[model samples]
Every structure is written in structure tokens, then in C-alpha cells.
Target chain A: MEGNLNALTVVFTEFYYWITVVVMFLIHVGFCMYEVGVSRRRNHMHTLMKNTMVIPLVTVTFYLFGWWIYFGFQGGPGITGGIGDAPFAEPWSALMATHLSGPSPDLGVSGDEAALWSRLNGVFWAAFLLFSWTTASIVSGAVIERIRSGAFWMLAVVIGSFAWIIDAAWGWSSQGWMVKLLGYHDAYASGVVHGIAGGFALGVLIVLGPRLGKFRADGTPRDIPPHNRWLVTIGLFLIYTGFWGFYAACNIPIISPEGIAGQITGETWTATNIYLAPTTLSAITFNFIMSLSGGMMAAYVVSKGDAFWTYSGGLAGIISASAGNDLYHPIQALIIAAVVVVVIYKLHYWVERRFKIDDAVGAVAVHGYAGSLGVIIAGFMLWGQPSSPYEGFATINPLGNFLGAVIMFGLLGFLPGYICARILNAFGILRIPRKVELEGLDFEGDETYNASVAEVIAAEKAMV
Target chain B: MSTNGLTSWAVDLKDVGAIYPFQGTETVLVIILLVFWIGWHVLQTRAETREFEHDLAADKSGDEQRKAIDRY
Candidate 1:
């Protein structure tokens, strides 16, 4: 607390991240509402609880090791020289707890690193923790109804605290191997968060199989309409609102030239993306609204004004433009969003019918397909552009981004999901038993309810 | 030349303005987007008409409609 300006900036940055974490919490709330709304009445309670529990399960596990993965693996062990150190992020590290802005003898963190992290660590950890919950929640929606709570929670920890964080370290970090060698860029985590989650959901879908009567005997898919269209629409709206905070959280808030230590030379301070490249809040705001409008309009036409698709399309639109939202023109964002929505909608059905995959919500298409497409499209859209302000990094290219998309969706996302699901299935814990699923996961609880109601009604009659 | 006219970000932040790709093609892009916007409505109206016609022809006995209403 030496200089007034320095103290103000540090406190303001902390408050800024704290507010974003609160707003981003609505993303999980929206996911719960949307999932339960899409599920049948018999499955509502189970669906809600299943998504809700991802919060505590992921939060604890993320605190234990997930935060460590982000800082420790940014080097790829070979790309940025060797295995990086992150003692401050460790669970038992003294720096992980509350401390005044001074170097501690209890932790191995250097004086310089400790001074910077002392104020920023908790809020930064919280912001990333919110992202962890979002990634896991994305998978929770696609596999509702038949999945066991135990199995789903295990999967949540894997994706929430492990898979997505590893991908973030690889692609989203400024000094990531993908950034250094491949020029991989996902400014708003289209591929890092949405793409990977979507891919993991698809991988599980392949092994878990469809919910009992998802397809007819002749190989045609059946439409299982949402129980509450209003809830689903409102949920999507809330998600869109929460996404504003998500966008802001992805930036550094404010940084001077000396802070960045990159090639951006000036006394002028500005907001930078994850890679320390310059951007502005005003630019992203324009693109966000424009892309969302483009998505909604295209979805209204394609789905013939279906409320669910219209809302989901707005999400898809933001996701499609998110890769380049940091730099895209509003109209460019609009057209890209429109084109991507059509592709994703078509792919959703094509994959559904071809594979008999029953995604309770259109998560695979909306998040997975849209996200992957966004990354690849950005490569072409932003080709020959610098992925980082740092020297010696490869320039952004179509081939690099295409490969990066595969690595995000298939390598990190799908592979781990399939392996974990297969192991769980072999142990007979991946899905509920056939009888329980057919009767509804809430069958026992519902029976207890009926019995209690009968006894209460009889007692009231006797009193009368 | 890069899409945004800067292949590298190794420059002063104060000098940068618009960083989006293809800075001068805004008019052409808008025209194309307008066509897409208009075309969607035409296709949507046709699809809605066909769906309603199918619904009208199939279960006019009100059994399915009643079930749908009750379920909601």
C-alpha cells in the first residue's frame, strides 16, 4: 500500500474479478433451469440435483489441484523450456491462504511472485473455478435422465477440474505450447471451454447409449419435447446475461506496458486478452450484441421460430464469434454467427439420426460443434495475425487452428471422457439399472410421497 | 499483409485502432448479411406452413392435441 495509484489499481482489479465471479454463477443456475426444464416431470428432481452437485464436487477438487495445473503445465514441460514451478498454487502452500502483501517464510514462492500473487490469487482462483463449474455443467445437460449421480459426479470432477484445466493450460495460457508452436488462439475460450465440454459430452454419449426409447425400431429419432418451454427460454436468457461477465473476466482488466513485458511499447495502459495482446471492452460489446442478433435471427428461420432454438441460437452465436470477438467487426461477427448456426443446426440432426445419439439438450451441437467451427473459422478469419505480443511465437494460421480444434475437442475432451466412462460402465456404475430408468429415477421417492399423502389425508378425514 | 494489416502486435498500443480482419470490406459484408437475413424469413414461413398443414391433416380427431394440451 505504498503508492495511492498502485493500491487503487490492485483493489479495483480484485473487486472487478469478484463481481465477475458473482455474475458468472448465474451460468450454473441457467444450466440447472435449462436441464430440468428439458427433462420429463418424472426426471426433474434428479436432473436438478445432478447438475447442482457439480458445484461443490468441482469446487473442492479445483481447489485441491486444478488451480495448480493451470500454472504448472503452461510450459508443456518442453515447449517453454521445461516443467514450470507453481508452489504458490499448491493446496498446502502458505500463499494459498489469506496473507498480507509480504513474502512468507512458510511458502517457497519468491519475493517478487509472492507480492503479485498475495492480492490476486484468491479472486483469480475463484474466477477460474467458476469456469470449471461451467465446463462440467455443459456435460451434465447432455446426459440427463439415465445417468447415475455417482457416475455423473465422477465425470464432473474429471472434466471440471482436470480435462478443461489441462486444455486451458495448453491453449488458453499466454505461454502455452500451442501458442508458441502452433499459434493457437481462443481469445474467449470457444475451443478451450465450450469445445472441450461439448466433445466430452459426445464421448460419453457414445458409450452411455441413448435413453431407453430415444429411437424407433426402424432407426428414426423421436422428438422428446421439453416439459417447460418457458423455463428453458428464460434459462438461456440468464446465461446470455451472465456471459457478459464471462467476457470481461477473460481480459486482464488493466495493464501497463511494463506489466505486460511484451512488445506492446507505450506508457498508455489498456486491457489485454489472455495472451497480453491489446483489446477494448467497447469492441467486444459491439460484436457480442451483433453476433447474438445474427444467431437469433438465423435460428428463428431455421427452427421455424421455435423458442428453444432461438435462445440456444443466441448462445451459439456468441460462441461462434467468441474466438475473434476481441477483434472482429460487428458485421463480420453477425455473418459468421449466421453461417455457424446453420451448420451446427444441420449437424445436430445429422449426427443425431446417423448415430442415434440422444442429447437431452442440444449441447453437443450448440457448444461442441459451434465452438469447434468458431476456432477453425477464426484461423482463416484472422490468418497471418500474431497470436501473442511475445516474440518468437508462430503466426496464427488455418492449419494450426484446425489441429488445435481437434486437440481441444478430441484429444483432451473426448478421449478422457470415453476412457473414464468405459471404466465406470464396466464396473456397472455408469448408468441407472434398466428397471429404475424405465420407471423413472425418482420412482422410490415418488412412491414414498404418495404413501405419506395417503396417511395424511386419512388422518385429516378422521379429525373432521 | 495480414488480415488486420498488422502481422505482428509488436507495436505501440496507442497507435492501434480497429484490429478486426478485412477493415475496408464493411459495405460488401453488410449487403451479404442483409440477403441472409431476408432469405431466412422466406424459408421459415414455408416450413411453418407445411408443419401446420401436416398437423391439421393427421390428428383432426383432437386426441393428440388434447394430450399435448393436458401434458403441458
Candidate 2:
């Protein structure tokens, strides 16, 4: 009901986020396809279902508590402040539902707050929820065959609804403690989503162990080619498309200096990263494409033109440069991505051989290692840049970003993931039984379908 | 009265807010949803355990397993 400018801004912002949410859904679709494609034919249904179910499971739990965690724990809940306020994010908040800007008795907010949140909250929550699903799905691929579906779902909830959101709160949010104190600056969620999920998957893989026959008599890891390579190819392509949406979602889209209310001066409107520092859609697009190209080229050479690693390398490359993509020159992004891909590709095999981590889909290397390195790289590249528009906050630095990466990959990502998996493992529910793993995860379904086919065939033959 | 306190659309849109029904019962609904979610996990885990048990008890002949492997 305000002037046209305010109306257009609010509506445009709302619609912008809504479109991102729609596009981001392809990430899960891609995840489901990729996980299924990589798994053996015997494990197809189980792998697909395991990844597919993350959507509903994470969606509901994110609604229940994950959204609250993002808004409520931005201060680290203790480091710089106590649990911060985010009443609108609470599951029980009236603002969480359909509203049209006017205040109600049950709104628990002023008219202005209600107006702002009524249009924006659901879409914002949904965008974050997609990130949450991506986090869980990253883990889903790494531990496909042997992870008990129930146990994995529980772990998914832990990481998707709890662990990653907390990392996002401390590092990804504009006023997060990490930004304020550690000078953390991930323009996109190179670490907040990918790093945490990758580390989380690593922790789970450590306990779950590799699928049966994933290792040989000499203890060297087996190649385990995908049952269907086409699925993997298309899946990665879809993920790349969805990533465009993910990048857009990370920005504020449009905001004026007054809207940001920070050191950013002049009447010019601009898009901002999650930290509320200025960037542009054009800048990210340039960096995204260049870094992706760099990663694919490096990976093709490093992995000797392996289709799987090449695609994954492209993803890792984008993730590697994503931390500073907002401000990075396209060439810098490409070089960083290329360099990071080579390191991560070598490290992937090194860890697989030395530690015997059987990452079925190379998720740990692509997301976790690359994301952690990306953050640290950004600190050096964007050295001394303001982490926020707000006065008196820490500026981006190597040490701060390195610590932020550790916090993302180790403290928030790996720790919670390991602890949850350990608890589930202790209960004798983490891994499927040896016999079941050998028999294939889809034994029951396969048996039923086989019997149905046989019976129908016999009946038709008799009729003939 | 309507649950969201809107009896008609005759009023100004700017003066309206939450349009969902049972507005004040959000807390109660949330508690129920949480219970349902947790309960689903419990039921699912138990069922999965039973399924594994059934599979284990059915056969160790290795013939079917071999066929399944051959199918792969």
C-alpha cells in the first residue's frame, strides 16, 4: 500500500526468490539421478529412494527447526551474543503462513514487520530448504549402497535440518558471528553448503565403510564403474543448470544503500551476496562459466579424460571459486578452479588409497575438499576486503577465512556428522547387514517384480 | 467466525494479515507434526529391521544371490 517503488521492489524480490526456489529443485532431481546412476543395478532402487526421500524429509524438518536455526544462531548463540531473534522463522509463528501484510492479533509482530515478512518469508525459507536438501543429498551419494535407509534419513535430518543450518547461521548470514569476528566471506555457499555436506559424508563413510568388494585383496580401492553412465552425464548437466539458480538465490537481487543501511553509499541499487556486500549477477555468471571451464579442462587432463571425474571436476571448480566469485576476475576464478581441481583430484585418490574411504560418487573431494580450499583461497584473494557493509566489523583475511573453512568443514560439518553417525552405528542400525549388502539392497522389490512377471507370463502362455 | 478472523473480503487488503485457519493453534499443530515425524522414524526403523530379519531367515542357498549377481 506504499508508493509504487516500494511495491515493485518488494514484489520483485519476492518473485525473484520464488523463481530461484523453482529452479533449485532441479538440484535434487539431479542428485537422485546421479546417485542411482553410480550405484550398481542391484542397488538402483535403494540409491534412488535414499536420495529422493531427502526432499520431503529435509523439507519438513527444515520447516520445523532448520529455518529457525539460521535466523536465531547468527551470533553463534554465545560468541558475540545469545540466541538472536527470528520469531518469524519459528514454526509456530503466524508469519510463517499466508498473510497479506496487515497485522493480526496472533501475528506477534508489528505491522511493518508483518508486511515485510508476509511476502518474503516463505520463499526465503524455501530457498534455504533447497540448500538443506542439497547438503543432505551430497552425503547421500557418498554412502549409497551400505548405509541403512533409516539411519541415513536420520543423518540427513541431522545435517540437513541442523548441522548445515548452524554453519549457515554462523558463516553465511549477513550478521553471522563468523563474518563479524572471523571475517568470513563466502559470497556463495562454497563451504556453508558444499563443504559441510562433503565433510559430513566423509564422517559417515568413515563409519559405514565401503560397499562390499569396494576394496581388493591388496586393499587397493576398486574402480566400481557406474551401472549407467548416461544418467550420470545428464544428472551432472542438470545440476549445472540448477546451480545457475543457486547462484541467483545467493544474492539479494536488488537493494539500495538505504535498504542495506550500511557503508554502501549513493542512490544506486545493487545486488549483494549473503554477507550483504555488493556483487552483480553478471560478475557471478562470468566467474561461474570460466571456473567451470577451468575445472573441466584440468580434470580432463588430471583424470585422463574420464567422463565421471571430468564432470565432477567442473563442479569442484565452480565450488572452488564460488567463495570469491562475486569479486574475483574471471581469469582468477578459472585459475583458482583449475588449481583446486588438480589438488582435489589428487587428494581424492590419495585419501581413498591411504585412508580407504570409498566415496561412491567422489562427493567428498568435489564438495568438501574443494569448498574448504575455496574459502581459504578467497581469504587470500579478497584480502582486507570488508566482510560486511556494517562499520567496525572484521575485514576478510587469510587467517579468518582459513578458520572459517575449518569451522565449516571440521567443526560444524564433520563433527556433528561423525557424532550422529557414531550414535546410529552404536545402535547397530547404521550399515545394512553383510548378507543384505551382498544380496543387493533391492532384493525384495526385485523378487516381487520377478514373481509378478513370471506369473503373468505363465497365464498368457496357458491361454495361448 | 472464520478461523483466521476474516469473515469477508469486503475489507481493505492492506488491513488483512494471516489468512490461514486455526491461527493460534500453530503451536499445537507444530507439536503434533513433530510427534508424527518422530513416530514415523520409529515405525520405519522397526519395519526395516523386520524386513532385514525376514530376508536373513528366508535363504542362504546362495543360488538366488548368484542369479541376482548374474543379472547385474
Candidate 3:
């Protein structure tokens, strides 16, 4: 009977993650379409391809090392302890490949670990890989027309596989040093993924320089609107759909107190966040809709029904309240989302005018600034609450989350991006040549497409 | 003679684990996959650079640019 129950639990958990991976694929689709809508017709193909390729580029590299880093570096490699053992996540571990969950001492994983992790490994890896792709794609939309695809792909790999995973290990993991020491908590990666990626895009943009003709001699900014307004709104809607899956993937579907090994005193089975703290899908569901409503309402009033900002406000709202959605009252999530969205919108324009940083789609404000603020707000809202069920862990606090936001957006996000962009610029491989930018990134491809269309039309005319 | 080492289904399910062929070759498979992944990026970058150079050479006339803008 015990064997049957264990098998049932494992299978159910496996299926749960598989479903989440399928839903998360829409986030990539939405990102690709949104970028294409934002870019000009002349640069459409390049914009689409740049975002599309992040899927494969990040996936392969994440498989190579990113998964291992999450479990391996939880101790900060020195903060809490030495590099931890994560045999199941090793690229060459048999558990990472096809397995029936049977004993195989030849594999790096022990028999016990294999029994638990083998079925869950692939789906778990894929779910995190989708998040990595999201982080990389956030940077893609900000540097559309002028950046080289090769340089961008390289940057994507660094963020998707290296930088974001390191932050996750530090803050998102149950045993992460940040959670253990400072009581850092971001249930849905408001800072770990969005904040870091947003900051990284800002760093790259500063060094890559704004799009040509983006600023005038007087230093006032011009509004470069999306070519397909409808497409942009539709893409935002699709992103909202995928974000639902993202929230689900952040949980352990079902586990008992015995499994958690923490301070909770009950035999009850429950879902938990990545930090092994109690939460429920029902609580987050209520929070997601209310927060989204608050953001859209605030943005409609602020932007005066501007389609792009209004839709983006919905996303920024969700991101802003994401950190504490796991625990906040629905009304708290709504107010937080409303306040953060308004601030991010105002800050977006202020930064653009103040610094002449031409962010094509407000990625920095929506993701970086909003995400960082969300982490800080979660700290204050949940202050003195237990960060984890584990004994002796720090309780959630304002100071810890604020420092966490800085580390995510500055240390891990902006620093690497700035250094990388500077190096790529020095090597003269960062941006497209000026003539190429003016003529458009897809000049030759467009010409070919044009010639083919004319020939097809002429042939059809003859048939008439 | 079965490829998966599974000739019968009468055995207890608890004894089953890895049923795939080449079970012990995970290390070699990973090395091969790693090389392919890196090699793809190298080849792809070269192709992309050449394509960009071609686009720069072919677009001296701004006719295509005007048509694209007008279409928009």
C-alpha cells in the first residue's frame, strides 16, 4: 500500500510540471510576437528571429550547467557551507536522462534520491528552462533594431543560464543562504528573474547606445510606436496566460510535514513555494486577477487609455505584486499592484527624458524597476513572518529584501551586462553598422521576399 | 533479445528503473551533445555575419525601404 501511494504521488507531481511546461511555451510565443509588433516592418524578420532563437540557445546551455548551479551553490559556495552535492542535476547523471526510477548505482545519484527525483527531473528542468528563456527574451525586446543577433544570443546565454540561476540559488531555493540568513523571499521570482533581466537590459542599452535618430539635438525623446497596435495587445494577453503557468511551476504540488522536515506540526499534505513555505493555488488565483485589475485601472487613468502602456501596465502590475501574492490578502495585492504600476510608468518616462536611454518597449521599467520594488514591498508586507518552515531561519524583513533587490538588479544583472556590452563594443561586434541600421536589419531578405511576391503576382495575372 | 531488456511484463514493477537502451552511456552522450551545441553557435554566428554583410552591400538603393514604410 505504501509503495502504491508513493508511486501515485510521484506520477501526479510529474504530470503537474509537464502541464506547466506546455503552458509556459506561450510566454515565448507572446514575446516573439510582441517584439515583431514593436519593430518596424523593415526589421520584422530580425526581431522575430532574435527572440525565437533564445528558446534553443538558453535551453541547451541551461541543460549544460544552469540546473546544477541551482542546487550546487545554495550555500553561496561559502556563506552557509561549501558547494552542495546535486548529483541528480549533473548533466551526465542518469537521472537526468530516461529512467524508470529504478536503482542504478552507476549513475551519480544514490538509490534513494533516484527514487524521488528521477521522474520529476526532466519536467522540473524544463519548467526552469522556460523561465530562463523568459529572462533572456526580456532583454531582446529592448535592443531590437541595432544589436547584432550573435552578440545578443551570447548575452542571452549568459543571463538565461548563468546570472539568473545564480540569483535563484542565492534567493529562490529553500536552502539558499539569503533565505537562511536574511529571510529573503520572492515566491514567484519578481526580482530573481524579472528584476535581474530588466537591469541587464538597461546596462546593455546604456553601452549599446540608443537607436539611431531616437534623440534630437534638444535632447527630447520621440515616441516610436508599435507598428501593429492590435498585435501588441494580443501578445500581452498571451503573456498573461503563460504567467499563470509560471505561478504554478513555482510550487511543490503536494507534500506532507514529514517531507518538509520543518517546523510545521501536522500530517497534512499541502503545496509549497520554492522555499518550502505553505501557500495555495487558490490564494494566488485570487491575487492574480485582483492585482491585474488594479494595474489596468491605474494605467488607463495614467496613460489616458494608451493601448501599449495600458497592456504593459497589466504585466507590470502582476510583476509588482508577484513577490507576496503567495501570502497577501487579495486587496493588498490589488493596492500594491496599482501603486507599483503608476510608479513604474512615471519612472519609465522620467528615465528616458533624464538620461536619453531609449528603451524601445519599456522593458526596464516594467520588469527591472517594478520587480525590484515588488521584492522590497514583499519584505515590508511580510515582515517578522517566518521566511521558511525550517528552524532558525530569519524572518522576512525590509532590510533583507531591499538588499536582495540590489544584489539581483545591480550585482548580478547590470554589472555583467555592462561589462559584456563594453567588451562587445570594443571588439566592434555589438551593434550593426550605421548604414545597416538605416537600411534596416533585414534589407536583403525583404528584397528577396518582394521579388518573389512580384513574380507570383505576375504569374497569376497571366493565368487570369 | 529485447532492446529494452524487457522481455516480460510479469515481474514486479518495483524492480524496474532504467529501461532505455545504452543506459550506461550517459557520460558519452552528454559530451557529444555539448560539442554539438557549441559547434552550432559557432556556425550560426558566421552565417549571420555573412548575411548582414550581404544586406549592407545590396541596399544602396532606398527603394525597398520606402516600399516597406509605405506598406506599413
Query: In terms of TM-score, which candidate is strongest?
Result: 1
lDDT of 3 by residue, A1-464 (tens): 13787888888999999999999999988998899999998899999999999999999999999999999999999999899899889998888899876765576666656777888999999999999999999999999999999999999999999999999999999899999999897998899999999999999999998998988889998888889988988898899899999999999998877778776664677788899877788878888887887787667667756888888989999899888888776666777887899999999999999999989989999999999999999988777767788888887889999999999999999999999999999999999999999999999999999999999999999999
Candidate lDDT values, in order: 0.90, 0.86, 0.87
By summed lDDT, the worst window of 10 consecutive residues in model 3 chain A runs over A103-112
DockQ comparison, 1 vs 2, better candidate: 1
Docking outcome class, model 2: incorrect
Candidate 3's DockQ is 0.01
- Name the 10 consecutive residues with the lowest summed lDDT in model 1 chain A: A103-112
Query: What is the C-alpha lDDT profile of model 1 across A215-318, one tens digit per residue?
Result: 99998999989999999998999899889989989988888888788887778898888888888888888988999999999888888789999999999999
List chain A TM-scores, every candidate, in order: 0.97, 0.98, 0.98
Q: Calculate DockQ per candidate and list them.
A: 0.66, 0.01, 0.01
lDDT of 2 by residue, A1-464 (tens): 47788789889999999999999988888888888899898999998889888889999999999999998998888998999888899898878988787756477677767877998999999999999999999999999899999999999999999999999999998889999998898988899988998999988889889988999999998889999999997899889889989999999999877787776656777787898776789889988998898798778767756788989999999999999898776666777898899999999999999999999999999999999999999988777667787877887789999998999899988888888889999999999999999999999999998999999999999999
CAPRI category for model 1: medium
What is the total number of backbone clashes in candidate 3?
A: 2
Error of 2 at A422 (Å): 1.1
Q: Per-candidate TM vs. native?
A: 0.95, 0.86, 0.86
Better of 1 and 2 by lDDT: 1
The alpha-carbon deviation from the true structure for residue A243 of candidate 3, after best TM-score superposition, in angstroms, is 0.2
